[model samples]
Target: MSELIIGVLGLQGAVSEHIKQIEATHCKGIIVKKPEQLHDIDGLILPGGESTTMRKLIDRYGFLEPLKQFSLQQKPIFGTCAGMVLVAKDLTDSDDVHLKLMDVRVKRNAFGRQKESFEATLQIKGFESPYTAVFIRAPYIETAGDQVAVLATYENKIVAAKQDHILVSAFHPELTSDTRFMKLFVDMVKKSKEIAAY
Candidate 1:
């Protein structure tokens, strides 16, 4: 209804970069720091950050309830890195608690620590350019349920996946100038609109 208000959950890392990338698509982006900020958004972009810390903020701000409610609305959501972890269906083995929105399991810092952070040119499915993905203390998606569709892979592991209207990328697509993945997500928003119009 409202003109495409996409929110970036801003409690932790890479918040600004998500906002910048979302703006590039010409969609109005809002910073969602509290539960009250979740209203009226057409979609949400959860940025790469410390999953543990972000979880604490969600609990502290009393946003866990409203945020989950918003997500269940089936509004398009694009989550990267820690965002991917947050959206996962389960974090049973991990120490960090997550919102568990996506039906997958992710291990935090599965690649390496800060010093092990590296960049790779990924051949993402359904994209033109070989996307330059930045993985900084990133999480690795271990298992994707049947509902999850693998979008990209690295080292024979599932790195990007989409389940229903939710898209999750294990690497930081926002850190780079590459807008391909971001554009893909924006397209999801447009698709959501089209589906609703019918």
Candidate 2:
């Protein structure tokens, strides 16, 4: 298989950390600041950041439509932290939704404020063991549609899930050295590329 190229949305958030994790998966990581850059990558990551601010940047750069088109192309997309909020189809208290690519309803800052941030080991679905999840004013999935597969939960609140090529986690997986989560996305990209080639 050829080396996969993964782009991290660089509008705002933990861009560098996600880049590092993508590289750890033996894939080329590029910062996607423009909509055109989306065409050069096989997969994309929406890292953790302030959703409102990120949304402003995304709109400012004309990325909203292009991003939705990217997902429509069946290219793998992994959203973490505030990225989870970006991809969710519904918001608990607000009608404003960014990508609306994932079939989940999310509640922003469901975990509380910044001072309430902490880490916990999570037993994610399909993983052999627990994965350390870092939550910093994270959001949780209030409800998921039939197509969404719940991956992990904390305090009975959905924290991780996947639907086809779209994956989301409410915690900062890039903050940890563990590359399993990133690797999983890489594999998804590879499979997507393979299917496209055929």
How well does each candidate superpose onto the true structure, as a TM-score? 0.92, 0.98
> Which candidate has the highest TM-score of all?
2
Q: Model 2: per-residue lDDT, tens digit, 1-198?
A: 778999999999999999999999889999999999998999999999999999999999999999999999999999998999999999997999889998899999897675358998999988998999999889999999999999999999999999999999999989999888888888899999999999
Off by over 4 Å in 2: none
Across residues 61-158, which tens digit of lDDT does each residue of candidate 1 receive?
89888878877877788888878888887774665556778888887788765535888888888887688888888777788899888988889878
Which pairs in model 2 have colliding backbones? Answer: none
RMSD of each: 1.8, 1.0
Off by over 4 Å in 1: none
lDDT of 1 at 89: 76
Each prediction's whole-model lDDT (CA): 0.82, 0.93
CA displacement after TM-score superposition, residue 102 of candidate 2 (Å): 1.0
TM-score of model 1 relative to the true fold?
0.92
Candidate 2 accuracy as TM-score:
0.98
The residue pairs that clash in candidate 1, if any, are: 87-102
